[model samples]
Target: MAATLRNLKIKTSTCKRIVKELHSYEKEVERESAKTADMKAKGADPYDLKQQENVLAESRMMIPDCHKRLEAALTDLKGTLVEIEEELNQKEGPEFEEAQKVITEVEQVLQSTEA
Candidate 1:
């Protein structure tokens, strides 16, 4: 039980870190897109435009893998929760509440990423 809880905590932490990375990558993509648009509007050189486009493409490619990792981490956390649900039900208190909170957070992050 202790090992399961520890593993859950580790997975939760990993998921949180991945989500943060996702947000950071998204922001970078947005910025790159805006820059590309601005450059196009200014009639920038084709070489420069291609460079910006390639960078944007690379960032877009990274997003799917990040999402996959986060999804896997969430699945692992959910599985862990299921495995311990009986124990959690028998013991009711702050630990239970904390576990519930973690579940809710993971669900919310998953939903947002899916959207």
Candidate 2:
């Protein structure tokens, strides 16, 4: 039981961290994309525009990578939840509830990304 709870906690932590990382990457990409667009609108030099586009591409790349990590973390969390669901049911509390919430949120993110 102790091991189960510990695993649950670790999985939840990983999910939460990956979620945050994904959000950070998404925001960075959005910001960089906006900057690139603004540069284009301003008739920025071709060389500078290419550099900005490269930066935007790098930021965009991080997002897909982050999504992959989040997907793995989500899978691990779901597996852990399934393994210990019965035990957690008897001990339902803030921790269990939080884990469920994380799962729901991550699922929504996954769906959005897929589209």
Candidate 3:
């Protein structure tokens, strides 16, 4: 039971990290888009515009990839938490049930965000 809880905790921490990284990636994409806009305003050449378009395409792909990673990580973390809850329920003791409820609530929020 202890080991299961520890694993869930680790997964949750990893999911948090994934979320943070994805947010950072989103900010970077926005910043690059702004830069491209500024370049256009400054009268960049057609070739430069094409290069900026390519960069935007790559950045757009990266945002979705990061979002996918975050969703996957959250799913894994939620699964681990559910498993830990089942184990605790079987044993029928202590604070695990309450902890499981909290985790479930968090999982619902994450799942909603993914949808």
Worst 10 contiguous positions by lDDT, candidate 1: 88-97
The best candidate by TM-score is 2
Off by over 4 Å in 2: 86-91
Once fitted onto the true fold, the runs of candidate 3 whose alpha carbons sit more than 4 angstroms away are 90-115
Candidate 2, 25-85: lDDT as tens digits? 8898899989999999999999999999999999888888888889999898888887787
- State the weakest 10-residue window (summed lDDT) of model 2: 86-95
For model 2 the TM-score comes to 0.88
* Candidate 3: 10-residue stretch with minimal lDDT: 90-99
- Residue pairs with colliding backbones in model 1 are none
Q: What is the C-alpha lDDT profile of model 1 across 10-83, one tens digit per residue?
A: 76677778878888888889999999999999999999999999999998888888888878887876776677
The per-residue C-alpha lDDT of model 1 at residue 26 equals 86
Looking at model 2, the pairs that clash are none
| Model 2: lDDT of residue 67 | 88
Q: What's the CA error at residue 53 for candidate 2, in Å?
A: 0.4
81: Cα error in model 2, Å: 1.3
lDDT of 3 by residue, 1-115 (tens): 6777667667766766766676676677898899899889999998998899888888778766776776677677667766765767643333345445545654664565465
